[model samples]
Target: MMKIFGKVAAIVAGSALVATAAFAEDRKSYPAPKDHPLSEIISGYEFRTPETRALQDDDFENPAYILLDLGAELWSTADGAAGKSCASCHGDAAESMKGIGASFPKWSKERNKAITVEQQINICREEQMQADTWKWTKDPNMLGMTIFVKNQSRGMPIVLDNSPEMETVRKLGEEVYYTRYGQLDMSCANCHEDYYGNYIRADMLSQGQINGFPTYRLKWNGVGSTHRRFKGCMKNIRANPFKPQGEEFTALEAYMMYRAVGLPIETPSVRN
Candidate 1:
């Protein structure tokens, strides 16, 4: 009887060990190559080939510059019932918008949320421009306004201060980054962290940072916003895409900016 009791106890212990091991394996099943090393991850700009880099170097050649010029016109031109152009309130784009891109998806007290430059543009449009806000796909003007604003902060490092009030928002964003979704049962980290530098067909994956947003994509043949890329990634993994400027995407943006804190802002960057 004593021998039989000892045998039963040993079997239970072995079962417990097996269960624990399984749990651990599940937790680490899809990890970044270096566990998402902050120091080692390079900017997408760095991942570019010399030919692509050269294209981005010339302001005249980069196609995204057209939007920059348009944005300047939109900035100064008056519209809407208020007849208040962005310039009427803000004075000058260079002076008023400098380093502005680096500071957003910063916490907005009035909105009680993280707001991106695009969202801010619309907000200003309704309030300041007294005009309609431009949607992402239909209008090139949105891209124009966005890249123009981002260009002011070019070369400046991304600055995201996760304040005490914003702790929950940032946490939510982090959860979104790691949480698995879609048919592939993968998260952003699975691609950006785990598969960085790996080829997904012809394209090599980078850390998936948005420091170079309002970026020109060869795939799109046009400049796209950070949220546009987010939706694309979700769709690629067979997940339902979020609204272009939705709250969840804003949270994700906040977290991504944190992930890429200290990285230089490189607007109108070229990507394949």
Candidate 2:
């Protein structure tokens, strides 16, 4: 598997090096909300090659489905001291989880802060299942379960909380998005907002939207969450990344979702 992955990586890197001289011109435009910063919104999907998009469109071809299937199994398999499964409480996820993913990073009244689906999964495991929490980016079970739940909301437009509390969170995220960080002194906006569609070494910078996470990236050779992507970008800029599931990332997730207001949920989306 490592050999295969290394070969794929080398080929992708080689192609990227060849394409470095050209700016991407394949971005699809969508009308932004009245109050949005940009006049248009673009999904990261548009930045990928047609082959990758085709993989995302075909359930059988998309490698992410392997993990999604695991999530489906985990949903029914009982676990922890309580001997309860997610299916035990939620019943049929098709019915119970529908549209839930599109409205996540929601204000948690009990926690008194915005919480992500990843965090909520751990909360359920600890409080209800009496099971240990899965590591944010390291656990395949967490990534699988997250994508499974999100897949239920595929094609639904993203709709986020607009309460004053959520508004504050969104504002903080926006601040983080625009703030320069690390040795390179680059901000998220420098690539995603300003140079989107332009080549950055071997990759085209997209809008950096989070609507399609936990996405399947060819570079990772597997599925991963939005926070994983966050950590990667931070490292690329030579900054110390905040911990996954921490306040900063949660706030950023909330804000990015807000930016994706009308975009359809594309869970298990395939990306370069």
Candidate 3:
């Protein structure tokens, strides 16, 4: 991912160099050195304090485990107009959902669109269970159910499909991440991509990888989905945010996940 970041920085640096040609000796903010040390690790977890890491490693101590339990119960709870449980169609999530999370933000040929795992859960809820779609941030179960399913793929490397449509979606994601918005004139790339190791006041900025979500945040005292996090980021940036789980955010989520291609799955994780 740093290689990609390096490429982006080089372009920006080159442009600046051209604009200030006369200040050849005084030009500043060169592209990140090719050998930036932090580039080697993708997940922000590697950057967390040891105490934070320990919080995630211990399942019993992890606040997210509480949500995971909630997810498990809802998996078998009858719901919707049809009053069917998830177990009705898909038995034992451990068996049925192995590596499922690692393969999502994918093109669902049946649905004819790309979907996150959260969306897949809603599809099953609406189609098979005849239920209403879960609201992104409002529905607590949405995050938990996603965490329960994603935990099955723990430690697995993320893998995405290489279909043509997916390639197009990836481009859209790239556009969104790089496009500056809000009064600050910042893009996702500006903070996470360009200055990942930098700090903002008391908060340490991270690469903002999603392998950890539906993660337990000490801030929220809860597990939340990527879209929830995205909503927060948007609000902070002063951008008019898209609806969570909406198509635009889904595209951005897919791109972010793709950027984290080789990272291990660490759902139910703890982060600052």
Candidate 3 residue lDDT tens string, 1-272: 99999999999999976754553333222122254322443676765777998998898989989888989999999999999998888889889998888878889888788898888898889898999888767478887889889998998977777899887887798788889888777789888877765567777677788888888888886677888888888888999888988888989988887777767889989998
lDDT of 2 by residue, 1-272 (tens): 99999999999999996776343444666789887877688888988888989999999999999999999999998899999999999999999999989999999999999999988889999999998888999599999999999999999989978889999999999999989999999999888888887779988788898888999999998889999999999999999999898999999989999888888899989998
lDDT of each: 0.81, 0.90, 0.81
Candidate of highest lDDT = 2
Q: Please list all clashing residue pairs in model 1, or write none if there are none.
A: 32-194
Error of 1 at 104 (Å): 0.4
- Which structure is stronger by lDDT: 1 or 2? 2
Tens digits of per-residue lDDT for model 1, 1-272:
99999999999999988875564343211122343345453678766667887889898888888888998899888888788888898898899999998878777899787778888888988987678878974368988888898889998977766587566777888898999999998899999988765668888777898888888888889888888899999999999988888878888988887777777788988887
Model 2, residue 12: distance off in Å is: 27
Query: Which portions of model 1 miss their true places by more than 4 Å?
Result: 1-37
TM-score, predicted candidate 3 vs. hidden true structure: 0.83
Q: After superposition, how far is residue 61 of candidate 3 from its true place, in Å?
A: 1.0
Model 2 lDDT-worst window of ten: 20-29
